[model samples]
Target: MADEDNPDSGGTVIGYERELADITGAIDRYGTGAPSHIAIVAEPMAGRTTLVAEIRRIYGDRVNYLPLEFVIMDSTVLDCSTYEGDIILIDNCQFLSTRKIGGFDVLDMFLRTQITSKKLFITTWNIHSWQYLCSVMNLDAYFPTIVTLNRMDMPVLKQVILSRYKPGEIRFLDEGVAERSMFFSVIHSTMRLPFTSAEISVPWIKLNFTLMLRKLPRKKRVQISLEDVILEKINRIAYGNPGVALMLWDESLKDNAISLSAITETPFSISLDTNESFILSVILSMESLHAKDLAAIAGSEMDIDRVIYRLVQQRLVRDNAGYYSIEPFALGPVTDYLRKTRRLW
Candidate 1:
């Protein structure tokens, strides 16, 4: 809110003040006597890039930045020997490895080089990839300070969105409608075990009070702002990922006005076979990949074309040229599915 008018303030970087401070503090400590490396980890489109940009803004010319995009850059560029800065910033470190080849070799070399060099390395990683690498290589132990972004609260999310627009630039519709409340009944039953008696709780569907309330006349209910409802839904679908939230906001907007009914979430009932699911997870982790890369990751046995066709038909994936990626709105649902299936760590 303080920087609402400041053109340079890249919105509120909400929910990350402490993280920014810790990063800067580490840099300062390293400058004086202490030496440390930092890792900023978050899910895809969770503002890792924005956070890194803020870091560059804060440090200015004092820090050297190396942003990595594995899809476009060669793997050999990861060599840290050529970089001559005391403070190094690397983005998308997840690209160090791919599904076909275990890229721990490059990661090992990078880590070895950084550990020996007197430099403060600040890096960002995809949460899933970070977890995988940590499990495989104990990667967390290498970075003395690691800051993870958590799911943001409603108010912070609101501020983050509001910061992107000038006051009154966009209309927030408020339809005077009270949201329906859900209620459930728990049934307690007594059961006899083989050797002992026990009481257990069972959940049962109760009357749909919310539905009944919705049937009432509009005049009798307390009106909730449509803008609040829309934002709440966007935040929910985004799972507190700022980038995802912004994308949802842009997609939902119609002629500069947003309505509660206009905001919709991708259905989570996607059906994928084992191989399809694995390929989807790979795409989500990598953000995007070519068919060849997907095949390499899926292994020789997988019919990559059939899987891609199925996913595309379901609207779960979109193909650009030969590259494949999860549809924008489908990101949340895909992530939820992966988390449920333990594909995402």
Candidate 2:
């Protein structure tokens, strides 16, 4: 059967059988004359692009895809010229709505369009944006269906990585090693906060790392276990972000290793106990604080410059503009620690 007739057949749509089924079912009900679009949310490298590709392959040209990235403009001015179709896959729709622009207004208008027009639209957004949209702005009402792609579990992640290796080379992943690597991979993935831009897929970091690994001397390959190094570095640099991991791995080949030492080698590590307390205090006490504010909070004991610098580097906090705030998720840990130490309310 041609893809459009089936709407759920593709290699890229692996492990998402349920999501596919739900989408196709929705399409079948609403897609014949006009389609209803959905929102597919996932962390970076969680395979949003692949999902869009699968949707396109299944729906064929019946679906028009507009991949949105950093260039998210207002819906009022959006030119949907090439977007006339039964199904529209809007990848990285998060760019359209963020804290910078009044994302709520944009999302509100976009959702209104989906309802007024029977266009079956599937949008993929960063988890952060989705949370802000749904929780902060109460925009979840606009989305009839929402599917969140969580971190890949060990077994699944192992299967995903091993699948990339050819049958012959795949045997190199000793039983325990694959599982162990995946464990770390998942841990690394959780460290980086979730994002929603489906511009790339799982194998995003493939060739870059492989080409670099191949450059090693045959002797070093045997001694160092390139696979382990690759997994470790990929786990760290990309934080299980297949795209970023692959890119960093490739760059490492050209550049140098991005090891923990290299990351810490920067001249300082944030004094966790003291610095975290001070920083959190500043954030909680003030209406809003920036990196410079963090420096002030650190007082003379620690340099605010270094405190913000290190926290951002470690992914403990996010600095948007000059505003330095702990990442939304990371706040849990920081808050818990501070409370335990009698920091704040």
Candidate 3:
């Protein structure tokens, strides 16, 4: 679907109408007598900052925004007893704690202050960190209104990308090659014999070839535009994160043109042992960490060098100076794998 109505508009919040409305409604209710506290949870580069910006744009003076950067500031900033605004917006709440023991003291203090204060608090959290906190401390119980962002669907994803460019400004190239392919596979299994003198299990040896073919296109002209198809692929690779999708678009665009083949997808079948997965989870939660810090988090039982070497060999991570981080394109797949295995929490 083409977003012709708002073709010239860029940087507008897309696919978050319901979430915006819920947040605004909470603030409005707070103004009248209801006590409201909200928690906006999303993955990194999943548009938490964008949604907060939109809130600031709408509320203007009524909102007092406090962006927390824990790398520089510590728990002392959580002493919000002096804040005067009726509605307080805190971004990056994940910075309140670390992986070390007793690191959640800041979060505990903040929760205590929030419960006593009359002001409505709206906070944003990194999804992975939030999951960990939820599992460890039952953090979600404190926020009466929690809004978790869902991944964008294809139509909304198309609208978001198209809104960034003018009509026909970016060329969508098609190589004319097949959009998909087919393959065949063979399988072997064990079976039980039923008609024998006595029922027995035996190895089933048979020539079994299964053919899987890609769905062919309809005889009629395609309904979706080439740009839409490219955007769809980009969104798929990005796992529906708008910011990641935009980054992919920039990386794939060449000479003001983008092709279906230009957008690459990270291999989803990457295998990682438990130690590597734990180390990756730590790195992802912290963005980048030194080897010593990683080792500290991974504990002495783990051989950090071997795990790091394996991760580096797989191209899932990169080392900068003495720090390591997930590769840019690999973030989506790595995060998905960690989440699937329940290691991110």
> What's the lDDT for all of these models?
0.72, 0.54, 0.72
Candidate 2 vs candidate 3: the lDDT winner is 3
Q: Residue by residue across 1-345, what tens digits does model 2's lDDT show?
A: 112123455564545566678777877888465444577877545566666777787778787778653434458544454576767778777656544334356767777777677667778876545655666666566666666665443234445555544554432332222222322232412222358422222322223444354557875542445355445644443444444443444443323323332321011232465765666544533313555434543557776676666677777667778876555434435444655676553
Specify the poorest-scoring 10-residue window by lDDT in model 3. 205-214
Clashing pairs in 3: none
Q: Write the per-residue lDDT of candidate 3 for residues 1-345, one digit (tens) a residue.
A: 122233233344777777778788877778555467899987777678778888777777767889875332356776666777677899888777777766777788888888878888999988778888988998887887777766665567767777667787888898543243212111112233466321122323222111121233455333445665576577667766677777788898999899988887667467988888988887777666677767766777899999999998999889998788778778788887988998874
Q: After superposition, how far is residue 251 of candidate 1 from its true place, in Å?
A: 2.0
Model 1, range 1-345, lDDT digits (tens) per residue? 223234256544566786678778878888655468999887777767777877777777766888775543344676666666668898888877775566456777788777887778898888778888888788888888887775565557788888667888888776433233322222222233465322222323445344355457997655544465567667767766677788888887888888766677676578788888888898888776878777777777988889999999999899998888788778878887987888877
Alpha-carbon RMSD of each model: 8.5, 11.7, 11.1
TM-score of each model, paired residue for residue: 0.80, 0.54, 0.78
RMSD of 2: 11.7
Report lDDT (Cα) of residue 195, candidate 1. 55
